[model samples]
Target: MRICFPVSQEKGWESPVFGHFGSAPAFVIVDTDSGQLEEVTNGDLHHAHGMCQPLKALGGRQVDGVAVGGIGMGALMKLQAQGITVYRAVEGTVKDNLAMLKEGKLPVFSSDWTCAGHGHAGGCAHR
Candidate 1:
C-alpha cells in the first residue's frame, strides 16, 4: 500500500509531518511494499477556508491513504470520495508515521475527526 504524508519540508522520509493538510508545503508519498518515496510540492497550498484541492497537491500521483496531523471537513470528505483513506499522523517525522501506519497503530480519520477550522486548533495533537 502507498501512503501520503503532508510534510513541512521535502526531506523524503525524514521530513516532519505538517499540521494541516491544506496548507502543507509539500507531500511525501511512500510505497510501503517497495519502500520508494516521492516528494511533490503543494500547488494548491494556499486557498480559502474549505477550499482545499488535495488532488492538485497530489500532482497526478495515486495514493492509497493520507497520513495527516489535521484536515478540514471539506478536504477530508473529498479525499474519502476519491477512495483515499485518511489516517491520523503520528506525532513525528514522516518515517515515524509510516511505521505506525504499517503497524496499524494509527487511527483512521473520519469526518468527525476533522478540524473545526483551519490552523490545527481542535483536531490534531501535534501542530
Candidate 2:
C-alpha cells in the first residue's frame, strides 16, 4: 500500500505527522511493499479555511491511504470519494504510524471524527 502522511517537513520515516491535512507543508508518501519514500509539497497549502482541495494539496499524486492527525469533513469526504482511505494518525512519527498501519491497528476516519475547524484554544478537538 502506498500510504501518504501529511507532515510539516520531510524527515524520511521520522517525520512527525502534521495536525491538519489541509494546512500541512508537505507530504511523505511511503510505499509499504517496496519501502520507498517520496516527498511532495502541499500544492494548496495557502487556501482559505474549509476550502481545501485534497488532490491539489497532494500534488495530484494517487495514494492508497492517508495517515493524518486531523482532517476536515469536506476533505475527508472528498478523499473517500476518490477511493482513498483516511486513517486517524497516532501521536508519533511516520515510522510509528506505519508500523501500526501494517498491523491493522490504525482506525479509519469517518465523518463523525472529522475536524470541526482550526485555530482553536488547544487544537482540533477530533485530533
Candidate 3:
C-alpha cells in the first residue's frame, strides 16, 4: 500500500504532523512493501483553491491512502472523488506515522471530522 503523510518538518517520532492535503509543505509517502519514502516538496500553494498545486501535482500516484492532521472540505471531496482513501487525526512525526501504519494502528477517517491541535489556519474546522 502507498501512504502519504503531511508533516511540519522531518522531526523524530515526537514531532506532530500538521498541514492539510491541498496545501502542505511536504508529503512523506511510504511504500508499504519496501518501506521506502518518496518525499514530495511543494514550493507554491497560495491556498489557491480546493485543487491546490501539491494535490494536483500528485496525480496518478496510485496511493491507497493518505494520513494527515486535517483537511478542508474541498480538498476532501476532491481526493474522495479520485477514490483516494483519506485517513486523518494522525499526530506524530513522519517516522512514527509510518510505523503506526505498518502496525495497523493508523487512524482512519470517520464520518465525523477530527481536527484538533492541527492549527487550523483556514478555520474551516473539523477537517
Candidate 4:
C-alpha cells in the first residue's frame, strides 16, 4: 500500500510526521510493500486556513491513505471524497507511524476527530 505522511522535513523514513496535514513542510510517500519512498514539497503550505487542497500539496500523486496528527474538517472531507482513508498518526517519525499502521493501531479519522478550526499553526493536538 502507498501511504502518504505529512512531515516536517525531507528526511525520508526518518522524517517526523507533522502535526497538521495542511501546513506540513513536506510529505513522504512510502510504498510499504516495496520499501520505496519519495519526498515531495508541500506547494500549498502557505495557503489560508481551511483552504488546503491535499492533492495539490501532494503534487497530485495518488495515495491509498494519509497519516497525520490532525486535520481540519474541510481538508478531511476533501480527502474522504477522493476515496482516500485518513489515519491518526503517532507522535514519532514516519517509520514509527508506518509501523503503527501495519499493526492496526492507527485510528481511522472521522468527523469527530477533525479540528474545530484550521488546526494548530504547527500541527494539531493528538487525541
In terms of TM-score, the best-performing candidate is: 2
lDDT of 3: 0.63
lDDT of each: 0.86, 0.90, 0.63, 0.89
Q: Residue-wise lDDT of candidate 3 within 59-88, one digit each (tens)?
A: 446677888767766566666777878876
Q: Which regions of candidate 2 deviate over 4 angstroms?
A: 120-127
TM-scores, all models, native as reference:
0.90, 0.94, 0.72, 0.92
User: In model 1, where do residues sit more than 4 Å from their true spots?
Assistant: 119-127
Could you tell me which 10 consecutive residues in candidate 3 have the lowest summed lDDT?
Answer: 115-124
lDDT tens digits by residue: candidate 4, 1-127: 8999999889888999988898899999999889999999998888887788999999999999999988988899999999999999988999999999999999998788787664345446534
lDDT of 3 at 21: 62
Angstrom error of the Cα, residue 27, model 4: value is: 0.3
Residue 60 C-alpha lDDT in model 4: 94
- The 10-residue segment of model 4 with minimum total lDDT is 118-127
Best by lDDT: 2
Q: How many residue pairs clash in each candidate?
A: 0, 0, 0, 1
lDDT of 4 at 36: 98
